[model samples]
Target: MKKSIQLNQDNLEQIGNHIPVPNYNRTSETADIVHIGVGGFHRSHLAYYVHLLKNSGEASSLCGIGLREGDQNLHDIFKKQDHLYTLMVKHPDGKIEPEIIGSIIDFKMGTTDPEAVISQMAHKNTRIVSLTITEGGYNFNPTTGEFNFDNPDIQHELRHPNDPKTVYGFLTAALKRRRDAGLPAFTIMSCDNIEHNGDMARKMLLAFAETQNPDLAKWIAKEVTFPNSMVDRITPVTTPADIDILAQNSGVQDAWPVTCEPFIQWVVEDKFSNGRPAFEKVGVQFVPDVGPYEKMKLRLLNAGHSVMGILGAIHGHPTINACVEDELFAKYLGAFLDEEATPILGPIIGIDLEDYKDSLLERFANPNIKDSVSRICSESSAKLPKFLIPTIQENLATGGCIKFATLVLAAWCYYSDKQADQNGEPLEIIDAMQDELHKAATATSSDPLAFIRQESLFGELAENERFATTYTDMIQELYKTSEVKKLMRSLL
Candidate 1:
């Protein structure tokens, strides 16, 4: 017989002895809003907050939509368990607390039934359509944050509008349907890690709409609202251990489980088109402006990760905790944040750099959360501009030191080459620039300065004499040292 779908109260009470459960409710009624990209981060952060609001009898209109196709296992599990799953939050102090979240009422595979996605988007009751689609899904140019219209997906969608091919196409078709039916435009809230996420979404949507209907694009610009947001949480890829723990604690088998660190934050702009749920009651900060918050996160938190990911991975550290525990890695991370990142971020308001740095260290040292260097280092081309280059440019503009920033660039160049270490083991090079980087590394060039002058990669930075000279010096140092850890120690 199949196991019953019920939580063991005895087991819950036993675990309760270890971690105190906050008096937050965890039951939500049917949902009215729909969320795209139901990944680990969404499940741990947004879904948990929505569940709390539901349990507290505050918001009853929030549903989720999972986008991946051919994933019947996840759909079946949610169906059998009444759309409920336990989110295990692992605290930095090694405490685990499991709470049943029930805000998701349904799931639809967009690739399987595209019409169904369009139909749901046309629904008048669906007031907000939030997206957690990662940076790559946006079909944006890394150098220019604009939509890539020449992409095959966008081209296909343009040729065959009836059968939508991309997310942007589906959104435009759905909006067209709403326009014909006289439904109000839903607010488009982006919770991705990209800088100015709201603005990016708006720009892409408008660009897609303008291809066929300029009037529609204008109307959307005026009618729809895209609120900028800064979201923070260390949600690692789920492992087999997480599955076993969840099944043992919750008495329900979840096919797609998520585990995350205890730290969570969501800062959103206070703007909406049709209507919005009362998310403020569940700890979402609705501020008049989110620029300062966005800058703080994009620079300090994300930039710090970029600095540690390359250096730590070179030292053969797998997880963030492993890197933080190493004395050298810890000190390098501190210097990068304090001396390099913070100096450029001094102009941003509403940010306590010291407190934020402390919180970041604690989050990184969370042993229970297994964040991987490979995951953080992926898509460096898209991430570097948003996280690192802006700080570099700011420092240069203000006559600040660019030594550490140059070292970071040099480390990124070395990481992208996909070389082997002293042990002859292959190193993982995670980035979209893999092919280009390989070509650059293997080119017949003996001078490090010539290598730094690659226009395709550095753009205007290669033309700047001071920046190029510094980058050349770092590249030479890296080649001579041949050890990322040693180079980092010397710089610190």
Candidate 2:
């Protein structure tokens, strides 16, 4: 039996060659990119790209900054490991590729010291201040698509601007400092999943700035550049089992290592305010527009995850792989993509729609990547609107069939209402509108149209006679029979 070695800067030399360690010298490194939200996706995607550049002897580095208290654990882990962590890429064929990433030179916590966070972002050398703050962190009204000033965090920041908490507060305070110091504004790049993420950041930041100081907002609008980007990589939440498995396989014990699917893509619009790294040199796509690419991905890959997720939970399928492996589920999923999603996606450059759809099914069925159903099922309110809902609306407008999409929502209603799987195992439903959704879903007992009547979410879709009738029938049958798989087979 091989002895497992603790992963850190010192242990890199002792760790065997099977697991590749970073050859770059960290002692003399300086990070010019301040990446906020140092979670799994960032580690696997952006940091991995930087690691490639670093391996090729480019002086690329990133200082990771985490805002929420939840980020503290990663900060401590990075400190202990000297910002060195393994990235295990699981291929469909059960191949494990592990590499120690050394692109992150340091990690900071905004929760512990906001001033230090601001200082780093405002630093002269920091050319790019990137964000991976999740969908909810934007502090915007999803319906109105405007920054919410009434948010408690936004309000707190407005009251005390100097001592900041939220990303908006930190960014505004930092950009103001750079402006006051007569320094060039750093490019505010968003690496989140939202379509036109950079545009959203600019909207929210400018809104926050306008409230604080018109002149500062004007400066930000003029001087700063927010580049729209589309990032794709399925990085599941790391598990203890993943950690232990990586150790047993590679004989290297990593505390907070990240593992992801084999596929990775980054389509960035070349709209940086200041200088940026030669990310293109390391497989980052610099496109004229990321809109089409993003739309294609969201409508297909993400939407597929959502539909499968809701139904998977109901059928007691624990992971995405399990969901796709089911013949009935796979048939319905393929139908949803081919008939529903693909038609709406106008035309994506350099992509074969059939091939892309095939790849999606293959990726979903990869047993090595045990992407959890719960992870996909979490935050249904935020995710469904962005990923799946638009397909339903678009198809509805064109007189196309919405049976697949409608059933997805109907299943979601059943899942939210039952609050458990077919086996009576309670699901950990994580959503911002959890209570409200449950109330609405359960209210269907009295009012069959309850869930669809959420004008905020459904937006008059309930008024559409065809959709409302179909959804009503599906949810009713789901309650009556509780046979999710049988229903899916009927659809196909």
Candidate 3:
């Protein structure tokens, strides 16, 4: 048996044939970017891009600042492996391409020491402070489209500004120091999946800053530039199985290997205060306005994922690949896009609508990727509004077909029942609003609007006669039988 290569800075040369190893001298590189959340998607996406830039000998490197205590796993793995990890992109044809990314030179866990993370952000070399802290991390109320000031973390940060606990706290404090010291502000870039994410980040950061110091908020509004971006890549949470795949296939044992589809895209606005890396060289699109692209991606791809994820979970599909394998589910997804979502969509520059839809189906069905249904299913409360609700709202405005989108919500209500699948295995309800959703879903026996009536989740859409009727009907049909193919067919 061939010996498994232990992944570390020293082992790069030994595994060059099996995986593309970075030839850049990582030790000499300084941190040009400080990414807030050091998770799988960031590893396979942004950091990977920086790795490409670093390999070109651009001297641009990264420092990962972790927020969640759960991120300690990343800190431990990167620390032990000399900040090296494997990125294995799987193709539909069963070919796996592995690359050892060496872009991240250091990591600081904020849960342990906020001061260190703040210092890294305030550094002169840190030209960009990026974030992938998930959708919920922004601490904004999804319904109101404003910062949730009542959040304990935001409150804590406001009270103890210097020794901060949240992203806002760390950002505001760091920027304040830089401002006071007369250093140029680093670009506040958000790589998350929110529409107008740059604006959202700026708003929340300034809101938090205002609570601490209004002067600081004013300075940030004037000095810092938060560039909106549309980032696309189906990066699943890495499983233990992925680690084993790396060890057996690539002759490398990576503790926290990031696996993703070969397709990756980033469309970023060119508005940056400080300088940025030459990300454009690595296929990152510098767009005039990311609005159209963001909508295209969020509605079609992300919203499509939620529909499949919820219904797939109820159908006992383990992964997205399995969901697309079912012809009925694929047809449902296509119909959802073409009939319900496409009419609401504006023109996407240089993208064919049909080709993009087909590509989404192909990407979802890549058998090797093993993207989990539950991973996409989690946080439906936040995702539905961001991804799907716009379609519903627009359809209502334009008088288009909304049956498909309504059914997607109904599927969510059914899936949120907190019960087992047909196999009698317990279905995990993983939402911030789990208890309320579960209660509402389970209480559909009394009032079908129990879940939909949640003002934060559905807003006034539940009151619409057309949507209300369709949603109620979906709930009734879901209760009668687990099969939804016929129901989906009826919409078409």
Candidate 4:
């Protein structure tokens, strides 16, 4: 029996008893943290944590700010429900735990009204400006690992500081106001998946700020704090069917409900300019340094995804679970984690590497999540550098086993060049540097080093005989044989 209850502040109490709703007073809450790039991950991870804290009567709320024109859809969906949405955690055995999260008190889009968004960021009550912008959003040079100051958006920001478009622009404008008004600058926490995310955010933001206003940039540098955080949880892209399923199973009609796997982890550095919620009481780990934990997640979990994503894509696997369900694929991924990725990492204080690796395999194999392989495969140009390249660099420097890592890189070359599986099925290819990658990969016969020679992404890896030799060999074998599984078996 499906009950009909549209999700909103007015109807939170009306939602069926099966679904958990916020018990606190929503009317009195104001924005404490202004989050940029609001989407599924934000809802499930940060918002989910805030919802938990608020359940304990914590005085903190999230004000989501969407910066892009594409974010208008966010306005359409979140505004309808008074920024209320259901988070449905899909367990491995097909059970769901639905909770109505009320941590987000307001949502604003810079696309509609930039002034409102800037004002919200500059407000006295807004003590933190956090972000979940994806890896490429930083606008940093992937090779040199520096903030790209010449980016048109940065230039546009310098030219017209008042009318801002990019996140950097908005932050610069708002920070200027705060400085001029003599209000203390807020903490700039980055919950994105990048390693040392807070540090990277600080570097990139400061670089942009330096270009426009050197004096204000110095003030921001002196006063502001950026906390690096390692956030984890697999929240797949929400589907139309997800909405319907939530309605059917939980009887909560949320237009853009979030669905994710059961597990979640947040490790934040204990550094903030303004005060932060007592998040540690609600399962958030606040440590002195988030470096070890972040490196483990990035090199193991994120890198593991790329190992399977590229190989599974070329073999025509539709979803991550389906791909891992294949015995050969599973074996190859496990060996890559055990033999290649795990070797370079230093031991963390509390974590067991073996347990973490096993858990990742189980997480990827969760049938209920149906995590998309193509979704994992998206933006490999950005992902590979952050995830896999570190392992490669570390191995090459230490003279460790580069076999599995090299093969994965070669597999990516094939995936990029063909843009289709062996059976001629078209793959869903999405990458920022696709044109350059495709061009370099297709020219492998004449210039075996062409792909890795792209200094922006690969740096000098192409010059290294050991890596280039294996990459060239495996790439040739892939094009010649096209038996992706057999290739894996041979490597194993």
Candidate 5:
């Protein structure tokens, strides 16, 4: 006979002794919140907070709806354990805390049965609809911060609003249902990492809604609440090692286990339309304005990640910790953040830039967290504007040093080559610019100046003499060094 799966109160208690499990209880009452992307981050951050609130005998009405497509595997896994899972927090000091979070009560695969999703959204009890759907899911124009209505998914949803085909469509349909039923419009909280996420979400949702019902759009504009939020946590991709740890320590088989760094920060605008759960009790910072905090995080934390990611990948470093441990790479990252990125970030309220930079270095150098360069390297096209370009633009306008910007662009160009070094190990190039990059790689010109002229990557920055000169010179220097370590050292 197969070995019996072992998960009981005893085993749970043993695990809880080592880590704190969320002592949240679920009443027979229905859910008040629906989270769109039920990924690792959601489990580690938002769900854990909600679970804490529920455990403290507050927000008993709050529960979660995990949205997925055709893949019911997650749904099946959660159902097997009564929608409960252990979240392991890996601290920089080598301490591990595992917690069983139990806020999520239901899972729905909207792609398989759209009607089920629509019905769930139409529920009168649903007051908050939050999302962790990554930047790409929004179908937004990075520069304009507007919904790309021409997106096939958005187009399909627009054409068939009632029988909705996308997330936005489902949301619009659900709100219309609520409006018709005389229920309050649910607050839409975007927990994504995008800058001004709440406003961006509102704009996109409203733009899409306007294309269908102008009056409905106006009503939503007046009634619905979209609260801006700033979220920070370093969540690495789950590995086999994590699975083994969970199985051995927690005595549970979790196919989708989540692991994260100990540090987590969430800042939200103090606004809710249909009321909200008591998240404040669980360390969520409620601020009148999240802009300063958002700017601090976007420029410091995110920008720092991009710098480390590109340079680390080129250096053949596997993880962020490894990259930061290397003397040469660490110096380059520090200079990029402090000298280049920090100077451009205008004054942020209640934050010391130097202290934040030091904390960032410590986080990036945390040996326990294995955040891979490849994970951070994905969607460079989408990430660059938000994380890197702003600093570059600011520095250029203010006549500040452009060395870091130059090196960053060069590192990105090198990463796009899709060629391995002396060991023949391949570098993963993840970006929308892949095809054109490949074409450029085969070109006869060895001049770095010629490469930057490619409009697709640099746009008008290529024509700007100051930027072109600095970027081109750095690329040539990097090519001469031929090794990431040496290239980084030369910059230092």
Candidate 6:
């Protein structure tokens, strides 16, 4: 077999695969958007759109900002490939389409040069600063919804003005530089799954700036625009097996590849301080308010993930596809939506709720995209409050069926017990509050209210007799049966 050529501008002509390459001249294009947290999802979903815009004769492109400690790997890979990477889109019918994404014209790791990262954001031409820094990256209190001023990095940034570590620090410093240089403030767009993500970003950044400089804080609050967006795509962490497959399919050895489901959606609130991209020219939705779409995705899809990921882990299911393949699992998810989740969601424009729910089941059952249950199971401390608890709360308010939501909360608590799965393999409990969660979960086997008693997560909500009873009964049921599938089926 011929040795596969490396994915780069110089090697584009050497490739023989049918995968489309960028049409624009890479050397001439400028970075108009600087994206933070350059992970798999952003590359697959957001940068894919930028690739479309750039390839369709648009001048703007994206430059990723990697500030985390271990970002050197990303820097090295992008440098090796000239910022060119392949995205494998897995369709439901088992067809995998590979496309080379070149819109990410530049990428800089802040670990080596923090100042350069700041400068990139402060650059005059960069109009948009977007993020996909996951749920926990925001560092906000789940209960209070306030920026964690007491976080060590935030404290360090506060003490030392010249040097900084956190994203909040970087944004504050960059915006300050831009303001001083008489450049217009860039729009801050958050693509995270958190509800009201743009609003959260604005609040946190403003809070950070207020501590550093009250004037700068006021300027950011008045001048900058933060647009809320709803982004959906199932892009899992790239594995070695995926890389070898990309090599075979594309005949190009990509150092770091991204694989995602073919279904992609982005709904952005059409608000920007500076001029924005003509993203609407492509398939991006430029809506007046992203609230409805955001709510729908978070409640139905995200909460459903929580339900499946945790329950699936307990039942020894590895990947999401494997979990959804079970008839009991599928039926339980259907009941979850029909009984609990759907009732809480308001009417979304142009969306038939029933059809949307059906599509979600189909997407989850996509065998080609092997999104893992364990991946979704990570960071439950941050995720459950934002994703699942809202539905619980609303269900309580409306006097709706809390059975399925209660079961999900119970599943999470039981899964957190450091207990072994059905196969006798120990399930890894990963969370910021790992030890505490473990202790609480162990206690819940004896005292059902132990986990919910944590005031930060459950608070006064647990004090409600109806929810408390339902939760306790479900936990009790878990203790009786190692077969979670049977339990869920019984509930259905």
Q: Arrange candidates, best lDDT first.
A: 2, 4, 3, 6, 5, 1
TM-score of each prediction: 0.90, 0.98, 0.98, 0.98, 0.92, 0.97
> lDDT of all predictions, in order shown?
0.74, 0.89, 0.88, 0.89, 0.77, 0.87
Q: 1-492 in candidate 4: lDDT tens per residue?
A: 587689988988778476789998989767999999998999999999999999998888999998888788877888899989999899999898889999999989887799999999999999999998899999998999998877787788889999998889899999999999999999999988899999999999888888889999999999999998999999999999998988888788889989999999999989889888999989999999999999999998898888888888888888889888999988988888888788888979899999999999999999999988788989999999999998998999998888887887887888878888878898888888889889988887787677788898899998888888888888788889877877788888
Residue 316: error of model 5 in Å?
Answer: 0.2
Give candidate 1 regions above 4 Å deviation: 1-30, 66-82, 249-251, 346-350, 419-422, 444-457
RMSD of each: 3.8, 1.3, 1.2, 1.2, 2.9, 1.4
Report how far off residue 297 is in candidate 2 (Å): 0.6
Model 1 C-alpha lDDT per residue in residues 46-130, reported as the tens digit of each score: 8877777766776544455655563456666666655666688898777777665666767766777878878887788888888
In model 3, the number of clashes is 0
lDDT of 2 at 397: 92
Clashing pairs in 3: none
**Which lDDT tens digits does candidate 5 get at residues 305-419?**
9898887787788889998898888888888887888776778777888998999999999899889999898887777777787788788889987777678777777777645
Off by over 4 Å in 4: none
- In model 4, pairs of residues that clash are none
| Candidate with more favorable, higher TM-score: 4 or 5 | 4
State the displacement of the C-alpha of residue 153, model 2, in Å, after optimal TM-score superposition: 0.6
Worst window of 10 by summed lDDT in candidate 6: 12-21
- Candidate 3's C-alpha lDDT? 0.88
Candidate 2 structure lDDT? 0.89
Name the lDDT of candidate 5.
Answer: 0.77
* lDDT, candidate 3, at 351: 89
